[model samples]
Target chain A: MKMAWKEIKKSKAKFIILGSIVFLVSLLTFIISGLANGLSMDNAALIKDMPAGQFYMDENAKETYNLSKIDEDTEKHVHKEYPDAAAFSIQMGFVVDGNDDQHSVSFVTSTESDLFENVNDGEIILDRSMQEDGIQVGDKLTNNQYSGEFTVKGFVDQKKYSHTPVAFISMDNYKEMYRTNHMQLLFIPGQDKAETINGLEAFSNTAFLDTIPSYSAEQMSLNMIIWFLVIISGMLFAIFFYMMNVQKIGLYGILKAIGVKTRTLFGMMWSQMLLITAIALVLSVSFSHLFNRVAPDGMPFDLGLETTLQLSGLFIVIGFIGATLSGIQIKRVEPLQAIQQGEM
Target chain B: MTAFTVENVKKTFTNGEIEEQVLNGVNLALKEGEITALVGASGSGKSTLLTIAAGLQHASAGQVMFQGKNLTNMKQEEIRKVRAQDFGFVFQASHLVPFLTVEEQLLLMLDVSEKRMHKQEKKKRITSMLQLVEMEHRKDAYPSSLSGGEKQRVAIARAIIHEPKLLFADEPTASLDSKRSQDVMELIRELTKTLHITTLMVTHDEEMLPYADRIITMKDGLIV
Candidate 1:
């Protein structure tokens, strides 16, 4: 083990090059993984934390509950029976501030109930991302399409859907502006026995969330990008390691001629790869955090410990497989060739 | 008794349809504690014979016995073990690993040999081996920093570090100047006598012949 380390240390330049490539690949992997997780969070943050065990939506609503409608009378009937039921209307659209600056937003209107408790009156709650658009408290933002003027009240941490920031408002105000007689959805908390009330379709919260248009599409798109990046990075790592092993063919021959077992040579090569990959992963993760700090607002990225661990495990496994595949070439080396070639 | 015996050794090479016989029915015996020189012209099958004896190559039709065990009947791994523990070789070119210092090179041989030694004991053996070659002071220098003659000396120290009974030297002094060549041959002879090692050296340098206990001259793959 000591001698193997010495040999690797002597070839520091080659190892550095290999390490750099692996680091770059690992960095890309980390970023892509973060993006995938961020996209999922951004799309579901509003509903993920909602205090509802199940939501009711029309079965024929196609992809989104926003387009689905249930009557006020039916909502009231379900509330009377379940006692914890709540009804809400959701609208996703764009709004222009007084300065004519257009910003994407998700508008939610909830009845005064625990399930709809996140909603506040004429004051609109904006996501922190809206700060970049120069909107602040006391500033008026309007959506002429919805026929209302909204006051920027305060900011929420990360409430968003489909890349748009979300805002909460009262149900009456929502009804006056959007001019709809029916509520788009209903929420029921811990009332699995609630009978099907008139003029409303019943669903579990998980099912209703999936019915949001662009939720699956958005997730699929981000996941595809993440998958592509992982495959590309893995292949690039394999190729770089393979080339380095090929370059050391002569050294392998010499070691073999000196009666070093093939298994020992394999152990050295694997250790070298693992050492390089571990160092590269650390560097790449550090660089990723540094970049995240300097990035401008709305650049979606979310790197959690879970994601980091997953990517690290992936790199180690891929690196080991790559090193093993490259090591197959060692068996082809003839010890006699080293004797003929003059050892350096 | 002979340390190694070769009987009717023959090696033939075929390129496409043409066949070339490099060695034809060559018989030889290498006795213990004697420095035997094999002198031959190029293409006289001398290197091939050495390779066969070292178990680095297989003979077309012959038997090579090292300590009365037929090398031809041994498995590949078994042959490697024999080479590792019982045989030592010095090539025409000094084949020191570039990454290892002179002392480390010698220790590497001891590490591979089946014989187990403690770390301190291994270090002491390496130190004494280097001292034998008068390279004790240069033990820490990598092969790249060494002069040609010094590299050859390190190579010799590495070869004999495991104290193998049989040593094969194929043109060991081929790359050195005349003075260095004579010094290397004398060192080889002295080490063989001091360690009671049987040595077979293949050389074309007539000037170094005086150091050999016996000489076999060859031409056209036949002993002259």
Candidate 2:
């Protein structure tokens, strides 16, 4: 093991080149992974913020949340069965500010429950993102279909739906504007097994998120990119270590001739790999976390500690497998062949 | 005393569908504290026989007896144990680990042989061995910094550091000039004599014949 470190120290340039390559690849992976996670949060932070639970919709709505309308009877039954349940409806719409600027939003209305923001009639709470568009608390916002005006009451952080800021309005206000009395879904918090109710389809929080029109497709593409990067980094390790091991074959054979254990040779290779990867992962993790803090407001890039740790662990394991796979040559080395080949 | 013996050793190498017999019915005995040299032309199986006897490769048939143990029937790991603990090797090239210093090379050999000693004692032995090879001045030098003769001297130091009963030298001086070759040979002869270590060496240079206590010639894969 000391010999391994000494060799690495003696041949600094070779190992440094290997380390820098790993660092760059891993940094790119962490940055891209952060983007994927951030975009997912941006797309559906409204439902994502909700506690783990089950969502019930009309079985006849064909798995689309907007088209699903739970009957008043089913909503009442769910509320009776689970006191924590809330009935809510979301519709993509636009509000016209006092300046006549039209702003797109997802108007969400839910019955009185702790799970959602319940506002009084004619008062609206908007996602903080709308504030950036010049809408402020106490500002009177109007809708083309409503007979009355809405006064912005407050703003909440990260409340978004379908890539649009959300506006929380009372059920009566929602009914008056949309001309509907039926809620689109009934949510019951903390149900391990969703009991079947007549004419209602139950969805886990994750399953319900996927049923959103573009959520699955958007996430699938981003997730595919993340996985592709992970696999590419893995292959990079394999190919790099393979080349290193090939160059050391004669040295390995001579070591074997002098009676060095095959396992000892493998230990040397693994130690070098671990040292290089640990340094690379540390740099990338630090830089990625730093980027997480300093990224621009418009850019969604969240590299959390858990995600960083998982990716770092994966890199180490992949590096081990890669270096070991390349080291299969060490096992096949014959002392006589190396002797015949001369100096390494 | 016969410290090592080979009985009718045979070795055949297979390359795809073709077969080549490198050693055929070769027999020999090596005495303790004696230097026995195997001399032959290219393709005469001297090197092959030496490697087989050193447990570097397997023979197709026959027995390799060392101190009453039949090494031919031993498992690969068992043979490796014997190779590590009881045998020393010097190849044609210095084959010093390019990354290690002259002193560190011998330390590695001691490690490979698993010689149990205190750190201070091990350091002392390395110092003495380096002085024996006249490489104590270059103890801290990496192999690349050493000339061919100096590197070969380090290789010999590494071989004898563990005090093994047998030393196998395959063209140990093949890569050096006449003066350096004579110096290396004289060093090997002196070390084997002083340390009471038996030596089996392969050499093609007839001018180097005088250093060996006994010389065996090979032709067409058999001792002649």
Candidate 3:
């Protein structure tokens, strides 16, 4: 281990170059992963904000939340059985401001419960993002479907569905606008396992999120990019270490001839690898967290501490595997052959 | 006393379908505290025999007896332990670790030999070894900063720092000038006598023969 540290100290330029490349790759990975996570949040913060629970939808809807409508009787039965249960509906529609400018919103309504923002009739609590568009409290917003006006009650943070801001309206307003008395989904919070209802199918939170039309496809592509970056960084370690070991074969051979244990050689290589990776990860994690704070308002980027730690752990493991794979050459080195090859 | 003995040692190399026999039924014994030199042409298998005797490679069909133990019968780990604790080697090139300073090279050797001396004692030994090699002035110098002869001097110091029972020198002076080569040979002779260390060395230079107590000339893998 002392020899390893001495080598790195002696060859500062070489190791620094390796460290810089690792830093760049890992930083890029962190940034892209943050963007993917942020986009995911933007796409489904409405459902994601809910606690872990079971959602029951009509069996005839066939895994499509939009097409599902829980019968009135089943909704009542679930509420009676699970007193904390709530029935909610989401419909994508447009609201025209006083200037007749149309803004797309997911109109959401729920039965009386603490899980949702229960608004008064003809009043709407919109996502705070609508405030940036000049829609203010006490302003009258109109919907063409019901020939009625909605007064803005207040603004809530981070409530979105299908990439659109949410407008929480009363159940009477939702029923009047859509001409429907039945809610689309019945949610029972904090259930370990979803109890089977006769006419309804049960979905866990994750399953219900996947039922959103574009959620999986959108996340799959971003996740692919993030993993590809991670794997590329791993291969980079393998290639870099392979090259370094190849150059030092003669030195390794000479060391072995002098009775240095092969395990000591491996320990040297591993210490160097861990040191380089740890430095790189530290820099990348710091920069990515800083980016999370300073990114443009329009950029969807959300890097958190937990995700950063998980990714850094993966980097260390992958770097170890890569470096160890390259170190197989060290095990194969013969002292006689190195001697025959001349000075290192 | 015979400190080390090799009996009918052989080594063969296989290149594709062709086999080349390098050493054929060679035998030798090294006396304690004496330098025995093996002189031969490039293809005479002297280097192969030296490597085999040093436990750098295995003998195909022979026994290498050191302190009454047959090295050829030992496992790889057992052989490595013997090589670490009982043997020292100096090659044609200096072969000092480039990253290590002169004093550090000797310290590394002590570590490899697993010398469980106190830190102060180890440092004292390293300092004394540096003075013996006349490298104390450049104890902090890396290999890149040292001249060829100086590097070989440090390499020699590294070899003998652990005070092994046997020393193997494979063309240890081949990389030095005439003056430096004589200096290195003198160092080897002085160390072997003062430490009572047995030495087996391979050389092609007839000028260097006088430093050895006995000379074995090989023509075709057989000592004459």
Candidate 4:
């Protein structure tokens, strides 16, 4: 360990270059991960925030939220069985504020329940994001399909769907706008096993999120980019260490001749790997979180602590594997060959 | 006293369909506090015999006895332990770790040998070793900054820092000019007598042979 540290101290430029690459790669990974997570929330915060449970829709709709429609009797039957169940409907539509400007929103309505916002007739509750666009409480809004103007009741935090701010309307208003007397889905929170209701298909919370339009595809592409960055960084890390080891082959052999155990040499490399990786991770994590803080509020970038920890753990494991792979050359080195190589 | 002996050591290298015998039944012994030089032509297997005796490589059929233990019968780990604790080596080209300072090189040698010295004693010993090698002034300098002779001096200092029982010098002066060669040879001879460490050296410089206590010449892997 002391030998490894001495090498690094004596050769700072090489190690700094390595550390910078790790920092850049890890920083990019964290940023991309944050964007993926933030976009996921932006696409379906309304559903993601809900407790774990099952969602039921029409079995014939074939795993689509918009096409799925639960009949009134089905909703009644589900509510009868689980009094805490919430029946909800969602449709993407536009609302005109007092300024006469049109804004797209995921119009939502739900039965009386604590899980969602329920407004009185002719009143609307919107995601707080809409408040930034000049919509305010008591402002009257209009939808082209509805006959009455909606008085904006209030706003809730992080209520979004399909990358649009959610606008919660009354069941009567939803019925009048979409001409739907029955809710589109039935949600029963906190149930480990979904009840077998006839004509209804059950979906876990995660499976239901996939049914959201463009949710899985968008997340899949972004997640693919994140994984690619991780893999590329791991390979780059291994190549860098491999190059370093190649240059030190003679030194390693001479050390072996002098009775330095191969394991000690490996420990040296590992300590260097750990020290460099640890320093880079700390900086990148700090910078990524700092970027989160200073970024524009409208930007979809949410780097959660849990996600950061998981990715950090992955980087360490990959770094270990990479460095160990390169250290194999050290074990194969022959001291006699090094002596013949002349001048380390 | 015969501190180490090699009996009928033979080594062969095999190609796809050919085998070349390098050391053919070589017999040798190194006396305590004596410097034995092996002089030979190129490909004469002097270095091979030296490496075999040093336990840096294995002989296909032979016994290498060191202090009552047969190195040929020992496992690699056991041989490594013996090398670390009882043997020191100086190669042809100094072979100092490029990134370590002269002082750090010696300290690392002590660490590798697992010497049980207090921190203060280790430091004092390093200081004295540097003085003995005439490298006290360059103790903080890295190998890159040192001249060829200075680097060899530091290498010698590192090899003896742990005070091993035997020292192997394979062309220790091969990279130096005549002046530096004589100076290094003189230092090795003086230290061998002072420390009472057995020495095994391989060289081709006839002018440098006078420093050895005894010289054995080899023509075809057999000493005459």
Candidate 5:
């Protein structure tokens, strides 16, 4: 083992070249994995963290809660059963501020003094991202479709959902703007029997989030990108490692001729690859963190420990497979060829 | 006792549809403490015969017995082990592993042996062998940094470091000047006698013939 390590150290140049390639592939894999997780979180962060146990939707609602509607009478019936039901109206739309800068918004409606009364009357609570639009607390904005001005009350930390920033307002204001008294969703706290309440369909919060339009499509698209990166990176690593093994065929022959067993030679080759890959992974992850730290706002780069560990594990598996494929050529090299040459 | 015996060994090569016989019914025996010289022209089967005796190449027919162990019938792995433990080789080109230093090349031979020696013992053996070949001064130098003569000396040291019973040299002095060649042959002969190691050296240089106890000359793959 010591001799094998020494030999690897002596061939530092080749190891460096191989290590650099693996590092680049690992870095790309890490970034892609993070993006995939981040995209999913970005799509469902606000809803996932919302303080709701179950949601009530109309039976006619397709897969999306936005298209679902329950009248005030149905809402009253649900609250009668659950008693902790919070009726809210939600819609996807764009809002223009006093400076005419347009920002996508997910408009939610409830009472100014009840369920969401923390939101002031005739005022909308915007996402923190709206700060980029130069909107202040006293500024007024109008919905593109509703054509009514609303005051900006304050900002919250959570960003967009389905690419739209959330705006909280009173149920009366939301009904007046959309010209409807029906609520899009009823947020109920605690586990309650979700039986048919006045012919309205009630579902768990998990099920409700899945029904959001474009959820599956968004997730699938991001997952495809990540999967493609992993496959391509694995293939590239296998090819590079295989070619490096081919180049070292003569060295293997020499070692065999000198009475080194095939298993020991294999151990040497595997050790070389493992050393290179482990170092590459460490370097790439460190560099990725550096990139994240120096990146400007809204760069869409998110690195988490879970994603990093998962990617590292993936690279190690690929490295082993690649190294095995490369070392397969060892059996074909005859020891005689090392002495006489010209024989493969 | 005979260290190696080759009986009617034959080897042939096929280039496209044309067949060429490289070794034709060659028979030879090397005894325990004798230095035998294999002299022949370039196309003669001297190196081929040495390769067969070393068990590095298989004879197409007939038998090669190293201490009565038939190499022709042995498996490749078995042959490799025998060669590693019982036989040593010196090539025409001083083929030292380029990456290893002089001391490392010698230690590598000891490392591959099935009989495990302690680190201190192995180190002492390597140091003494390097001193024997007068290469202790350059023990840390890589092959690429050494002169042709120096590299050949290192190769000789690597071969004998394990103290094998038989050593085969193929034109060991092929790359050296006349004086260096003489010095190398003398060193090989002196070591063979002192260690009581059987040696078979192939060479086209008749000038080095005086150092050999016996000379077997060949032409057109036939011993003359």
Candidate 6:
């Protein structure tokens, strides 16, 4: 350990370059991961905030939830079989507020269940974010598809879909607007395994989220970028360590010649790798968390502690594996080589 | 008394399908506390024999006996223990660790040799070794800052810090000029006598041969 540290102290510039590269790569991965997670939430907060469960949609809908139409009779049968199950429908529509400005919202209506907000006919409950846009309780709002104006009942928190705030309306209003009495999906909460339903396909909560149009593609692309960055970081670390090892092959030979145990030589390499990686992780974690907190509200960026720790752990593993793999140099060195080389 | 022996050691190197016998069945012994220098021309296998006897490399055939144990039959780890605890080396190049100070270089030697002494005692040993090499004034100097002569002095200090039973010097003065070479050779001779160490040295310089008690000349892989 002491020898390793002394080497680093003597060769500060080489180690500093490697450490800086690690820091930049990790920080970039962290930030992109944060954005991917945040965007996922933005795109599907309503379903994500729900308890773990199974969702059922029409089997012929071809895995597209919006195209799914669960027959009213089948919905009734599911509710009967799973007493706590709820039937719900979602559609994109615009509501005109008192200012006569149109705002897009995911219109939702659900059968009577504790999972959804309840409303009498002609009354509407909206996501609380609508309040920022000047919509208030008892305020009248209109939709071109519905003949009657809705009186805003209240607002719910974090109810969203398709990157838009959700507006909960009566079943009658949803039926009138979409011109369909058939609900799109049936939800049964707290199910470990989804049970098969007649004429419908079963999906877990996460699988159902993927069925949302553009949700999987957007998240998949962003997640791919994050992984690529991680892989590049690992490769970068390995190449740097290999280069450093090649440069020190002669030094290793000399150390071995002086009766240093091969194990001690390995210990020296490990300690150096650990020290460099630790410093880089500390810097990147601090900066990533700092950015997480100060990011503008308009930007969808959320870096949770769990994700940060996962990535940090991954980085350490890769760095360790890389350095250890590069230790072939130490093992391959011949003490006679020390007699060959005149200097370090 | 024979402290170390080399019996009919033959080493063959194969490059592609062509085989070259570097050392061909040669035998010799070194008396305890005596300096035996092997002087030969280039590629005469003097250095090869020295390295084989020091346990730095293995001979393809025959035995290297040190203290009644055949090094050729020992496991790698076992040979390593012998090298660490009983053998020391001074190469043509100083081979001082570039990152370490002169003092630390000696300390590392003590550590590798597994010397069981208190920290203060080890420090004292390092100080004494440095003083013997006339490098005590530059204990804190790095290898890079030292001149060719100074680095060789530090290297000599590191070699004997562990008080090994045998010392192997492979052209230890080759890197220095005439004056520095004489000084370094004098230091090696004096230290081996004081420590009662059996020494095997390989050198091309005829001038340094007089310092050894037994000067064996080699040609074509055999002592002539």
* Best candidate according to DockQ: 4
Identify the leading candidate in terms of TM-score: 4
lDDT of 1 at A131: 81
DockQ of each: 0.50, 0.70, 0.75, 0.81, 0.32, 0.71
lDDT of 5 by residue, B1-224 (tens): 67778899898988999988988899898888999999988989888888888887888888998766899999988988887888777877777777788999898888777558888999898889988899999999988789989988888887778878888898889889999999899889878888888999999999999999899998888788
Cα displacement (angstroms), candidate 5, residue A219, comes to 5.7
Candidate 6 local distance difference test against the native: 0.89
Clashing pairs in 6: none
Model with the higher DockQ, candidate 5 or 6: 6
- lDDT string for model 1 (A190-303, tens) is 755544655456666566666777777876776777667666656766776678667677777767766788888888877887888899999999988886687656678788
Q: Give the TM-score of candidate 1.
A: 0.83
Runs in model 3 deviating more than 4 A are A97-101, A134-137
DockQ (model 3, Cα):
0.75
Pitting candidate 2 against candidate 5, the one with the higher lDDT is 2
lDDT of 1: 0.80
TM-score of each: 0.83, 0.96, 0.97, 0.98, 0.79, 0.95
Give the alpha carbon lDDT tens digit for every residue of B109-155 in model 4: 99889999998899999999999989999998999999999999998
Pairs in clash, predicted candidate 5? A110-A171, A112-A117
Question: Model-by-model lDDT, in order?
Answer: 0.80, 0.90, 0.91, 0.91, 0.78, 0.89
Model 6 stretches astray by more than 4 angstroms: A120-123, A131-140, A148-157
Instruction: Write model 1 residue lDDT over B1-224, tens digit each, in one string.
Output: 68889999889989999998988988999888988899888899888888888888899988998877899899888888888887787888887878888888887789888678888999888888888999999998998899999998888887888999988999999999999998898889888899999998899989989999989987777677
Tell me which residue pairs clash in candidate 2. none
Candidate 3 docking quality: incorrect, acceptable, medium or high: medium
lDDT of 3 by residue, A126-183 (tens): 9998999999999999999866799999999989888889999999999999998889
Model 4 stretches with alpha carbons more than 4 Å out: none
Candidate 6 residue-wise lDDT, B1-224, digit = tens: 98989999999989999998999998998999999989888999999999899888889999999888999999888888898889988998888888999999999988888889999999988888888889999999999999999998888888888999999999999989999999998999999999998899998998898899999988888878
> In terms of TM-score, which candidate is stronger, 5 or 6?
6
